[model samples]
Target chain A: MLLPHWLFSDRAGLVLLAVLAVLGVGVPILNLWVPPDHPLYLSAYTVTVLGKYLCYALLAVSIDLVWGYMGILTLGHAAFFALGGYCLGMYLMRQIGARGVYGDPVLPDFMVFLNWSELPWYWHGFDHFGFAMLMVLVIPGLLAFVFGWFAFRSRVSGVYLSIITQALTYALMLAFFRNEMGFGGNNGLTDFKDLLGFSLQADGTRVVLFILSALALAGGYLLCRWLVSTRMGRVLVAIRDSEDRARFLGYRVERVKALVFTLSAMLAGVAGALYVPQVGIINPGEFAPLNSIEAVIWVAVGGRGTLVGAVIGAVLVNYAKTWLTGALPEVWLFALGGLFVTVTVLLPYGLIGLLQRREKAA
Target chain B: MSELVSELDAAGLHTPIEPVDATHGILLYLEEVTVSFDGFKAIDNLSLYIGDGELRCIIGPNGAGKTTMMDIITGKTKPDTGRVFFGQTIDLLKLDEPSIARIGIGRKFQRPTVIEPLTVLENLELAMSGAQRLDRLITARLTGEERDQIHAVLDQIGLTEHGGRLAGILAHGQKQWLEIGMLLMQKPRLLLVDEPVAGMTPAEMERTAELLRSLAGSHSVVVVEHDMGFVRSIADQVTVLHQGRVLAEGRLEDLQVDPMVIEVYLGAGDAYH
Candidate 1:
């Protein structure tokens, strides 16, 4: 398919696609062909890490779309992300089928342990991969639509709206943590054997999933680029700059906001679904408010309005986290906080702004 | 309800709007419209009328409820008691701002409020019909006529050369003109223009006066301005407002001598300047 002209023309976007394409093909080659102990070998663990970062990058892009373009700072965005994961996680659990510890073909291991007789009605079609895939987009999208409809219609915006979104995720976290919810309680859905009858443990499966993650990130980026390039995207920018003026121009401000928010949430959901199999577990912890805030931080530190900046921020921040946690585990939190403050204070437009400044100077 | 039914039937027979009723000679009407903010009457029993295809200029001093009156007409503020009508049929009071705008009333605020990030051309595009706005979002393409309409507005606003520039970078006078251009793009039947020449140069003000003068006959225009010279240049009928009531109303020549109008608005020193 011919991509939007802007995506290929934009230097950062071109660089992003080139890098993703290289990583997509090269990582699998290194992991599969290069022998371990040769120092150049790619480990299974690193593939998972890179794949997970792609997911985070996608999530950060989702936040950037709403917060940067539309002026909607949704702090509860990870609720949609985790909700998408849980939808896929449910399917992953159902895939365990006869292989689970309880070995009940009809019920997941947790349900059997809880003494439930049958699968919940909401869990019916999730056994089918296609149905689960539909859900990964729909559930988060529907939730966002309803939430944004009420919020935008009431004109609750700015920091107050952000606070309400945080309250929404915090509420969901408490609910999902309960055993009665039938989502594996605190343990979450785990012990996935395979996806589509292929052993998930296989090098081929991990490599393919990794490649798929890169494509999904690229696809989502292009889709967002196309959206913002449209007149509607300009309207989103208009709304961010001056909402009342937009309304005066006969644009239904609430409808526009609700639509963008829902779309952004669905993108976040896709990120979450990709995240689950690679990580192998999801729990109420995924619904944590902090996770969503961290996603926003990624967008801010990278560049709020720039699409490639989101991916860069997500990767750079996560990479810093990985290195920090391992190298100075006790000081990780302080270091992360310091990084956020320094970026926000010094590099207000983010690392991308720094690059642009250097480019101008040079 | 009976009149509405008959009007709807007449519109169905015709192409939506029949000629203005000769009995009132009014395209827009306000009767006993009063609104208070914490015991201060922003609009106090403000009865006013505008003839079809007439340009009416309203001049008032500070806190004279000029903005509040526009707010009421555009459905931004609900009057505690009054009737606001567009033509003979539609009740402006009963509608919301969007609906009022849809029903052919457009308002420009005191301050220029352009969507800063969008180009001048894109801002005008957003002000088109809602269907067109949605179409712009889904497809970046535009029909030939829509493109013409945008160029026409750019030319009309005298910003044809700056169509590609972001509105955020425009001068204050340009932003005001851009906003008026946006309102014009909507093709509203009635325009409630506020402070149209607030921060304009003498030359810019002359161009604005000419723009308002030309717009008057095809579109019923209500220009609320503090610039006495600009109002004199364009007003067919002038309304002088004081503490939310029409203190005086006449041709600008006659109102110049009315003691109430002189005392409230054109103070002794504010004369002929």
Candidate 2:
């Protein structure tokens, strides 16, 4: 929606914007205005599901920024996502104030339960929305910068980087699980009550958040579009295809990879921050290696390089997962694993490739 | 080490402000450069020099360290012991691969790499990003002059018609030419070309020679080729390597008849044409 005119002129881009606009506006009306007993009434649960998908869409776009565009297939991207969620979660926990069972003003209930006398220094400023927002962007951005700085400068690439990223998230998961780590033990941060003083239980606030998630998804898509349109984006693609050739052409390949990597992490951070409020909890479970792997599969199932394909992949896969877990229950993981295998073999470009083929056939 | 070629420059016409002027007339210098992969020395105590705007061709039988030597100069392979310099001020060993290119030495690989997914036009665009890339990434659209420059290179490489086509779909020879054209787009002061005409047809070889020759007065070029006919066609001075050291250095005709060169290069078969 914020795109400059010349950049926003693509027909597919326009269609995506239209779909997002409709969803952003219509979903709120359906959730808030229509009475629940009506046939076309949107359920609150459906609103939450759509909001979760939007956040995942943002995560998928973030992953695509590096994996699809630059070919850095990270398996630890969920680490950044979980970190961002924890940051916002800390702020929400602070907002809980004296209402907790432990009734400690500064320490979260978990810290009080652990007999911690004071707020940890790292957890100090997250109570402020401004500081929390900054942390949402910076912590993941800084970690990615440091990680990518070492990895890319050393020219570690392909599967090696992927392994390193997996190790990164797995390490984060273990550290967060420790009771001494001060991030709420294995349960992580939860029991959020409000955001900016609006009741988390309020349907009005839920509707607004759902709308905001849609807006963010649109913004992320356009941001990626702008990036890939730039000369830097072309340089990334060149690096992806041939790093040595791009290096010989004097691209400062490490810097390019680091820039995209850090930015991708920040975007994932935003998604995780958005994700926590709607889901009503953010746990160490979000940092699971399986979650990151699932995100990669979503991008693959959508289309590796296409930004729109990532959004489609995330929504469709999650929708399928949600539907399957409720209906068949036991077969979700097998279905997901099978989906990944099948996509790799038959639908190499995922659903987007299939659509393009159908369009040509038409 | 290269023979003094100041006389060649005094007769040549080129950019008024040349990238190489001092440094004792050498554009590139490698002294006592040694590199080992495992215990085997791929480049052993080798020293070489290339004069500015001099189209020097290096020819050696297999494993003469030709590719490895290019690697050392371009900062891909670090040497165990050596002083490598570009012009005089820039130390080639100290800078990374991209910086070597930024300071005006572009290299072509042994195998062609034209970034198959990118179009010929995009390949040129990316090559243009070697210098001042941050600014280009933000505000640089090809100025009319810059677009014209790409057009001119496209015409030179005879791929003007295929600028929009992805390089993957190009003919094998065209891919080679596209990579060369990509190097050309950077407008590097020196270009290290590796086996440029290896699999080219005779006509393509002839045109490539013409292209290389036309580039000599403005750009220093180091061409390493195995094709004796191609080397003879475009070499200004030939450097022959045998066992990671210079075996012969002179005009191709003179080196071809050198009995020492014949014994080292031909190996009793007299197979080299």
Docking class of 1: medium
> Global lDDT of each model?
0.87, 0.87
Off by over 4 Å in 1: A1-4, B1-24, B38-40, B130-136, B268-273
DockQ measured for candidate 1: 0.57
The Cα error of candidate 2 at residue B201, in Å, is 2.4
lDDT per residue for candidate 1 within B1-273, as digits (tens), equals 778865644332212323334256788888999999999999999999988889999888889899999888887788999998887877666555665665567889888999887889888988875433454567656789989999998998899999999999999989998998989988888888988998799998998888888888888999988788898889859998889999988899898878877776676464436
Specify the poorest-scoring 10-residue window by lDDT in model 2 chain A.
A5-14
**Stretch of 10 with least lDDT, candidate 1 chain A:** A1-10
Error of 1 at A159 (Å): 1.3
Scored by TM-score, the top model is 2
For each candidate, what's the DockQ?
0.57, 0.60
Error in Å for residue A39 of model 2 = 0.9
User: Which candidate ranks first by DockQ, i.e. highest?
Assistant: 2
